[model samples]
Target: MKHLTGPAYVDIRERALRFVRDELIPLEREARLGPEDPWPRDLLRRIWKRSNELGLLKAALPVELGGPGLSTVELCLLKAEIAETGALFALHVLGELSGPPRVGSLMNFASAYQIERFFKPVMEGDKGICFAMTEPHSGSDAASIKTSAVRDGDDLVINGRKHFISGSPFADIAIVICVTDPEAGPKGMTAVLVELDAPGVRMDETYVPMSGQHIDADIVFENVRVPAANVIGGFGNGLRLGMARVNLNRLLHTSWMIGAARKVYRMSLDYARTRMQSGGPIARFQAIQHMLADMATTLFACESMMLHAAMKADQGEDLRMEASACKVFISERCFEIADKAVQIHGNVGVTKNHPVELTFRQLRLARILTGTSEIQRNAVAREILQA
Candidate 1:
């Protein structure tokens, strides 16, 4: 399923590219960061439905689950392009990180009941889902997670706090990790599919994004009652599930960053070549030329790294370290490209009038969220020593 190839896949990629440029980007521009205007939920539904019509929303799932059910390569292609439009919009449309667990990795480990109860709603686009692993105390160290879920009869009683739970505030279901048997240490942690409406589940607050209105939630579970069937997998398997899901997201993050870098690089390249400065076009200046070169070089590198990880994922190999490396590398370099492009544009780039500034803010968030670069570096270093 991962070894996706053939001409039809390339055609789908092109169609995605066109849809992004022609439909997605234009619609999103109208909803750029604002103070009072919450993104209209109805409008988003319509847009998502349109994406469904285009067979985009299903790019990562199997055909039976109502997705494009594409090969890994096809998933990569759609992800890179859809992500280029803006992640906030992607969240609203793609069902909020629906690619990784909601597709299969999580599903494979989830009990049949968990799959039908949690994953189905997300795939059908009737609900949103988030992976709740990183906590204020744990972050990258999954072993240090403090959340606890105790089994009581047929229910798992959960209690803990999680921070930076991406899209959790708006999500309908939360796939959480909690220590089911703390005596076993990290192995004690378990995955549970707790509905947001569950008795003890509460979204504490939202993490306001840099350039968009997407809500990253801080979730609190106080004796949250999860049914036995809600368990994603067996006890201790939580860490394994968390790691694989993180790698999947890391790979997806790189692809999104590639799209982000490409958008601004191309914009700046065009700006550099045509915009006149001090009697002649600024692009003709040696300094501007260097900036252009830097942006292009970094962009190429980010894209290559993204493709490398995507290829590894297709091979059905462990990409934990590689995905971490890509996340750290692409996250940093992609932001740098956006920053330099903005510098090249001077005053024009700083204004909301230009997309470069918008992209600059967007790329900045990418670095800190989705497993920070610092966390990625720590993971990669550990992998090197083990090897």
Candidate 2:
């Protein structure tokens, strides 16, 4: 975490905290009106505008791209702090769950035209974007995506269905990965920028996952013709373009889990200290004390592992193993911490009114979303064996 400390980092971090406390937290109730309700677009736009003015909207991007160009460690630390606020609107404050920054390092590979037409508006808080790669049959196995894009003179006809695409319902465009040359296998795949309003493009259905957020949708492309110029990072390089941001994305997700765990730990601590049980407050019981100690200790370890991986990324080191290991360890441990928080709060923790309940559900999904724990473990095992 030392890598995250510096005068510049401190200034940006404090600003982000102030923005979250002053701007986002107060509106959490309105932003999260219901478990399955869509976020009010007007509210999100206001937050985005304010965050952009504060230089926090694109904080993870490079300076050349209209951002402050914070290092990976600093960006991850900032994300953790925002997530620590435990407000649903925190995701919108930094545009983490969606928009240009969510593309992560992949934006580095964008063509000038693509950046100007697609990326700039999103960065400026005027438009939105979603990464579309998961298909009906493909989840963690990206190579198996069945989405096909065939060349037709200067146009490409795209036909596929992407499910569980985050922000698709509201995004103006989607960075779609499609099979350009079936015979070439993984090398045949390419990433294309497809406007959601294109002909034959359909927002099929919205999904409210276990987290109860209506941020994901199923998108169908039926002969959606896009100019060949929309291709990103050249043809047959979609996998590479997508993998470019995988390491940093994993670390960021881990930061969210760490922050959520911290929030729940505090909630549980306050509950234990005040909730009367047996002959005294729950904090006096060894059972509750043990849970608090475990939560605190594991949180420290999770933060250390996440920051170390983030530092490796900042140093330009390959983080295939480190990121997966960090994701696996932190996600699992923090989820466990959330479970302990629930236990310490007893029946009250599981109720919908309690923040711990939402935190529990959200942290549970972390293990499955950005590569499942089994997938991460397999990645680590493969690396170890090959080495």
Candidate 3:
């Protein structure tokens, strides 16, 4: 039961598919070249402008804002399809200039002035924002963050070091999570908007992950003063609000993981049919058939779970457990799918000529980012055991 139907949803999906297949997939080679490779920023900007004219860029935003206001299910479906081209394509379609896909959190929690100053500029593509929560020491244990934001007369003087923050290097602003009261533990945390150009804010360097597909940055704040009004959700409410943002992001990750898995499966299936074996194509063999079967089954099950979670979310259900379960299941299964794709393709899978090499590397990070498999399992167990 999807919340959207009729020609409108179908049109959105079809247009998105054509865009990914025709516009984005052609750039796979350039995009996967290396971490130091420059992004197709100008090309992407042109496509973005065209997409906005066609209403594609506005699909994730609310309807009242002159956008399509897609439901969770609709957004997931479109995202999964867009993801077939790759992460960069999916992100571009999701309005990369607006920062992350779930920057809706800012719309909900940011002050009117902050929205006018930051959010609007980001959405309008004049600026970029990065989430600065994962610290040098605080990755999964966000409660363990040591960054401090000392209250002053009309501002908070912040001092901290954040690394592995995506988009930080190119961002003009950052939503930084800091400890406003060390004594209050997680409850003492707060989210503050900081202008990267402000004094004492520095982008130390951009670090590449093992995949070497994207770059994250190390940022240091030394006595950076952010007006007190920039605080989101008020002081002592950061953890709760941050978790809320995580749930939405985890859901998007789950859907895109499925997309990447599906792409791997397709590559494997094509190879199986063409790669010669004993007498004919390997796809005719029972073993190859069984492998494809397993891949399809895994993809179907993961997609089902993703849709279930999305629907639950649309119905206003608390998806703490469902979101974690989806993240854990999809991450592991997507990796397995990619592994199977590699095994099926043998030597070709590892070659840069095919997309699997890049897919394999990116899928591996799916387990670690958003939340680790171990962390998500603990979260699910904790929720189930709670009184």
Who wins the lDDT comparison? 2
Instruction: Give a tens-digit lDDT track for model 1, residues 1-387.
Output: 224556656666666667667876677666673421355645656665666667666656665555445655556556666766653465444544532334456666666677677776666555667778889877667799989888899887889998878767557787788888878887888888878888877887645667654566689998888787787778778887877666876777677777777878888888887898688888889888898898888877877667777778878888878889988898889999999989988999998836788788878888887778888898899999999
What is the lDDT ranking, best to worst?
2, 3, 1
Ten contiguous residues minimizing lDDT sum, candidate 1: 92-101
Question: Candidates' TM-scores?
Answer: 0.87, 0.95, 0.90
CA displacement after TM-score superposition, residue 287 of candidate 1 (Å): 0.3
Candidate 3 structure quality by residue, lDDT tens digits, 1-387: 444554667888788777767766666555564433545545555655556655677677767654577777877887787787664556666674334353665577777898898877666655667788888887898889998999999999999999788766567788888999999999999989899999999887656776674447788999999899999889998788777668867887787788888988998999998999778999998877888999999998998899989889889888888989999999999999998898899899988736787788888998998889999999899989993
User: Would you list the C-alpha lDDT of every candidate in the order shown?
Assistant: 0.73, 0.85, 0.79
| Residue pairs with backbone atoms closer than 3 Å in model 3 (clashes) | none
Query: Candidate 3 overall Cα lDDT vs. reference?
Result: 0.79
- For candidate 1, the C-alpha RMSD (Å) to the true structure equals 3.3
The true-versus-predicted C-alpha distance at residue 219 of model 2, in Å, is 1.0
Model 1 misplaced regions, further than 4 Å: 1-5, 18-37, 62-74, 86-88, 91-93, 96-103
Q: How accurate is candidate 1 locally (lDDT)?
A: 0.73
Question: At residue 27, what lDDT does model 1 achieve?
Answer: 73
Candidate 2 per-residue lDDT over residues 221-266, each given as its tens digit: 9999999999988999998787777866887788788888999999
